[model samples]
Target: EPEVTQTPSHQVTQMGQEVILRCVPISNHLYFYWYRQILGQKVEFLVSFYNNEISEKSEIFDDQFSVERPDGSNFTLKIRSTKLEDSAMYFCASRGTARGNTIYFGEGSWLTVV
Candidate 1:
């Protein structure tokens, strides 16, 4: 069984610094997404990518954030000028098909901005 994998399970950074979270999804998956949860908040959707382009994005994905698939294998999320409010547990997920397909999520990458 294939699963999503994330690097640097936890990251600590200063405010105004930049951070990149990396993830690799199952080889056969087509749709990919990024979601985050504040320490005591509900999980929130950030962005969804498909066919090399952003298919959907939530308000949280503002100018400071970006996502890319530099090598068609690894998906990365870059946050520029991080703020204390940016600290959260970010999850990378992927799905094979849209209908009745299960979305697999990687072990979250915890980001701490202080």
Candidate 2:
């Protein structure tokens, strides 16, 4: 089975700075997503992409965040400005058409905003 992969496994940034996290989901997957888990909290959905466009996003994914599939294989999440509240482990996920919506997640990109 293929797995989602993420770059810069960990990052530390100052508050109000910009950060971009990158991922490569399983090659055959059809749907992609971004999710984040704040320290000691449950994972929260951020956004989902399908057919080269954003299909859905959560309230927590406000103006400060954006997602894109820059190429056939790369999916990225950009935080326009980081905040202490944004410190969390961001995960990249994907699911194929036959998986019954069972998304597979990457190890995660841990972000620390000071």
User: lDDT by residue for model 2 over 34-93, one digit each (tens)?
Assistant: 999999999999999999999999999999999989999999999999989999999999
Candidate 2's C-alpha lDDT?
0.95
On residues 1-114, what C-alpha lDDT tens digit does candidate 1 reach at each position?
789999879999999999999999888888999999999999999999999999999999999999999987999999999999999999999999664599999999999999
The positional error of residue 85 in candidate 2, measured at the CA in angstroms, is 0.2
Q: How many backbone clashes does candidate 2 have?
A: 0
TM of each candidate vs. truth: 0.97, 0.96
Worst 10 residues of 2 by lDDT: 95-104
After superposing candidate 1 on the true structure, give the runs of residues whose Cα lies further than 4 Å from its correct spot: none
lDDT of 1: 0.95
RMSD of each: 0.9, 1.1
